[model samples]
Target: MQNSDSDFFGRQGDEKILYVVRPHPLATTAALIKIYIISLAIFFVLVVLGSQIRVVSSIFYVGLQQIPEHLPGMR
Candidate 1:
């Protein structure tokens, strides 16, 4: 015979509970500042790279400079 008072399952007292965590405000502010600095650094790098490409290409193609007759196929 199965007894109803035997309490074989469906126990509520043995369950575990979890809690949520929050970050400190100072820590959050510091992280944002760090990210901002990194972003600025990357932006500066891109700008410098773009300028260099422009300068080098302009210098390389600036011409009606005569090609040497010795160069192949220019006869």
Candidate 2:
């Protein structure tokens, strides 16, 4: 027998559900834009740092060449 006191999902007759809260579309869009800008800034900073490190390493390696190749472990 189907029970009138309960619906198909099992909620009682007295139960009432409140409306779901959500952010406005414009607010959500602004948040996404902020995240994208911050991500781009971090990416550019890393690229610049990587290039700087390569340059410094090359300069240091050139300075090491003054030592004779016959020294132990030197190639």
Candidate 3:
């Protein structure tokens, strides 16, 4: 069956289209704002965690050097 402009996705002749579901503009805007805020918070948290990891790794490496090796040809 051929589809008409008013018909969607090969709808039958006896089928009636229901009201289209859509988010309201304000709801869309609020959802976008919420997503943006959550993204920013995650980004900041990752940045802080990354820096802390780097600091901890550096301290670990420095501490490693302070320990003397007991192996034969290793100073």
Query: Using lDDT as the measure, which candidate wins?
Result: 3
Best by TM-score: 3
RMSD (CA, Å), candidate 2 to true, equals 9.4
Which of the predicted structures, 1 or 2, would earn the higher TM-score when compared with the native?
A: 2
lDDT of 3 by residue, 43-64 (tens): 9999998877633346536667
lDDT of 1 by residue, 1-75 (tens): 332443324445755434335698999999999999999999999999887763323433576366566755433
- Identify the runs in model 2 with alpha carbons over 4 angstroms from their true place: 1-13, 55-75
23 Cα displacement, candidate 2 (Å): 1.1
**How well does candidate 2 match the true structure in TM-score terms?**
0.47
Q: Backbone clashes per model, in order?
A: 0, 0, 0
Off by over 4 Å in 1: 1-21, 55-75
Ten contiguous residues with the weakest lDDT in model 3? 66-75
In model 3, the Cα lDDT at residue 33 comes to 97
**Which digits, one per residue and each the tens of the lDDT, describe model 2 over residues 1-67?**
4534333356567776455456899998999999999999999999998877633346447777564
On a 0 to 1 TM-score scale, where does candidate 1 land against the true structure? 0.45
